[model samples]
Target: MRTSSTIRTRVTVKRTTRAAAALAAGALALSLTACGDDDKGDDSGDKGGGTKQPGVSVTLPKLDGESLSVAAVWTGTEQKNFKQVLTEFEKRTGAKVTFVPAQDPIINFLGSKIAGGAPPDVAMLPQPGAIKQAVDKGWAKPLGAEATKELGENYSQGWQGIGKVGGKQYGVYYKAANKSLIWYNARVFENAGAAEPKTWDELLNTAQMVYDSGVTPFSVGGADGWTLTDWFENVYLSQAGPEKYDQLAQHKIKWTDPSVKEALTTLAEIWGKKDFVAGGASGALQTEFPASVTQAFTGGDQPKAGMVYEGDFAQVNIGETKAKVGTDAKVFPFPAVGDTAPVVSGGDAAVILKDSKAAQALATWLASPDAAAIQAKLGGFLSPNKSIDSSVYPNEVQKKIADALIAAGDDFRFDMSDQAPQAFGGTPGKGEWKTLQDFLKNPKDVAGAQAKLEADAAAAYGG
Candidate 1:
C-alpha cells in the first residue's frame, strides 16, 4: 500500500477459519536462528523489571517449584527467544519450563498428546483459526482473569476478541507480521534507476523498468498457492477498505462480488502483461516460495528476479541468501492502490490446553509487556503489545515496521484468506490456491476466477 506512514485508523475484521489457517500456516512458521545473529540486538538489563507483554497486572503470581510444559511451532531462534521469556517466568515464579516443538498439523500433534493424557500445558497456535478449532474441540482452556485483563490492556480490542473463540477468551497473540510488504533487492532497484514504487501504477512501471534492464521483474512463487493468495489479499485490501475486507473474509460478501472481480481485474493489468513476470506466467506457477525470494536476491552466476512480495518474516529467507538485508535487500510497503496502505497482519496465539495455576500464571506472563520487551530487544521480532517501548527494537527499519503496525492500532485487519476453511485456505490442490493459480494463468478471465472462488468458498464455508 502507500508509504508506511499512511496507516489507517479504522479497523474491521471478519475472517474465515480456513483462510486464517492457510495464511498462518505459511506466514508464521519461521525462527530467525537460521537467518542471522539474533543476539545482535541490544539485550540490556530488563531495567524496568522483567520483560513483559504490554498492559495488565501489576504483579505476576509466584508458582515456584512447579513444572510446566509448553509447545509452539517455533524451531530455532524464536524458540530461543521464547525460552528467554520462559526463563524469566521461571526465574520469577520458580517454575521449570520446557519448550517443545508443536509439529505442523499442530492440531493433530496435540490431539495425540491429549489422547495419551499428556498434552502440553500451553500451546502457541499459528492461526486464530487453530485456536478456535482447539476451543471447539474442547482442548483449549480459557485464560485466567489476569491474562484476560492484560490481553485487553496490551492489545487492541479486535485482537482481544480474536483470542476469544465461541464467546470465551482462550488465546493470547504473541507475535505479528505486516504481510503487506514487498521485499526487493536494493541493487536491482538502483541498477534499474527505479525508486521503490509508492502506488500500483509505480509498481507496474518499476516492474517494466526492471524487465527492460535484462532481469525478470518479479520472482513469483506460484508453485505455492499460499503466496498467490497473499498477492490477492494485499490488492484486495488496498482496493477495498477494511469493511469490505471483513465482509469478504467472512464470506458475508461472496467471492463473486464485483469487488472481488475488480481486484482480480486490477491484478490483471500487471499479471496480464506478457513476460511482465519472471519465467513468464507458466514458469511462475511452478516456482515455490523460497525460490521466489532467492530469485530476487540471486546474483553471481544464476539469473535473478528484481522483487518478491511476502511478509516481514521473509527476512529469514533473505538471511539464507548471499544478499545483505537492509542494504542489498530493502523493503517498502506493498504499494497502495486505494486510499491508504492496505495493512493486513497475522500471528501465532498462545492458548492453554489444560488449566492449572502454573499454566494460567505462565499464560498471564506471556501476555505481559515485560515478556514481549525481552524478546523485542532481540532482532527480527514484532509484538502487538501496545505497552512495549519502541526503543526495544534493534533497528530503525524494524521500528518503522513496528510503528506502522502500532500506528495502525485497531485498524489492522488479519489476512482475509487466513479466515477461510482449511480445505479452502490451506488445502493445496483445492480452493483459492488452485483457483488463484488458474486465474494467474489467465488473469483476463476475472469473472471466471471469481465464480470458481465463490463456488469453492461456498462448499467449504457452508459445510
Candidate 2:
C-alpha cells in the first residue's frame, strides 16, 4: 500500500478532469488536422527543450485526440506538491495526464481498477511486492524495449528483474525510499558515555552500555506487523546476504534454515531485554511503529533515550519533532554482522498494465536520467539510476546513500516480505509474513508456526 495521504496532512490537484479533457480533445484535433504529426518518422523527435543527447530520441505518440490517465499512490507529505511535476511533463511532451490521487492502500486501488478493465495508464506502486501481485494476475504489460532502453539501468533493472515473473516486464519503478539505517541522538551518545560503533560488536556493546546507564538503546515499535518484519528482514539479510534473502522470498530457502533461525533468535534476544525497547516486548508488538519512533525521539522534554532504526521515511514521521536531522538525529547503515558487505534496504522499481503507448512513454521517461534527477531533487526520493551524479543529493545522509549504493558491489537487496506474495494468497513459503508476525508476538509458538507454514508452502508450491 502507498503511504496514506493522511500522513501527508495535505492535498492539492492542479489538473482537473475538465482541463485534461480539453487538452486531450485539443491534441487529437491537432493530430487529425496535421496528419503528418502522427507519422512514425515525424514523431521520433524529442518533444522537450531538446533530447538530453546520445539517448534514444523520444517522441511521444501523437495524443491523437487522447490522453493518459495515471492512477498514482504517493507517499509522505510531499505528494500533494507534485502537481508541478505533472504540469512540467504535460508542457514538455504536449501530452496531458489525468492523475487521480489514491488516498491509501494504493495497491487495492490498482488491483480493483485493473481487474475491472478500467486500469490507470500508469501506477505509482509504493510497495514492490504489490507490483508482483499485479503482474501475476496479468493486470499489467511488459514495458516496450524502447522504454526499457531509455530509462537507463538501475530504474530498468529494479523493475524489470522483479516485474518479469516468467520473462516479461510488467512495470517501470521510478522512485524508492531508503531503509537500513539507525537514527540516533548524537547528544545521547555523549551524555550516555558512548561513541558511534564501527562494527557489530561495538554496536551491541554500545547498546548495552546505554542500557546500563538507564537508557533505552533501541526503541522498536513492533506492534505494526510491518515494523517487526523490517527487523527480521534486515537482520536476516545482514546475516545471510541477498542471495539467501532472495532464496527465502522464492521459498527455496526454508524459514527453518539455521540462518533464518538465527535472525529470529537475535530479535527474540532483543525482545528478552526489558529496557532494550520502549514499551517493552508487548508494547513493541502493540505500538504503532511511527508513533513509537516519535516517542523514542521526544518522549521527554529533554528527548527520550538514544536511537531508533527506521527508513528514510522517518523524516516525514519525525519532521515535526525537536530531533532534527544533522543534530538530535543522524543515521548509520546497519553494520554488517560479520564480513558481509553492508546491504541497504530499499523499494524495487516495477511497471504495470504495460500495453498502452502512454504507459510506455511514461516508463521511458521514468527510466531517463532526467527523471532520476527530478526524483532526487523534487520528490526527495532515491532513484536507482546509478548513472546519476551523487551531487544531486540535498543532504549528507542522501549522499551517503548514493555512495553506499555505488559501493554495494552485488549485495544491494530489497526486503523478503516485500518480495513475498500478498498476505492472503500466493505459494506457501512465499506467504508466511503474516505468520511470522504472529510468531514474533508469541515466541513460544515459533516451532508450531514454522511447521504450519512449511506445510502450507509445500502444498502451494506442489513440493
Candidates in order have lDDT scores of: 0.70, 0.55
lDDT of 1 by residue, 202-298 (tens): 9999988888877777778787776778788878877876678889888998998989988999888777888777887898998866677777887
Q: Which candidate achieves the best lDDT against the true structure?
A: 1
Q: Taking the tens digit of each residue's C-alpha lDDT, what string does model 2 give over 1-463? A: 2222222110100111223322322221121010111111111224554344344334444443347776665534545434444554565567777777664346677767767878777776645566766776777677787776765455435334644556666656555554555767666776678876645677788888877767788877555455555666666766775567668767896766777777666666665556777766666666655676676578542354577876655655555566666666666655556444234445434364646665677777666655555445532355556666666655556655555444342334455555544452211123454566566556656566667666655565456
TM-score of 2: 0.77
Evaluated against the true structure, the overall lDDT of model 2 is 0.55
The stretch of ten residues in a row with the least summed lDDT in candidate 2 is 31-40
**Model 1 lDDT at residue 158:** 71
Best by TM-score: 1
Cα distance off (Å), candidate 1, residue 428: 4.0
Cα RMSD for predicted model 2: 12.6
Q: Give the TM-score of candidate 1.
A: 0.81
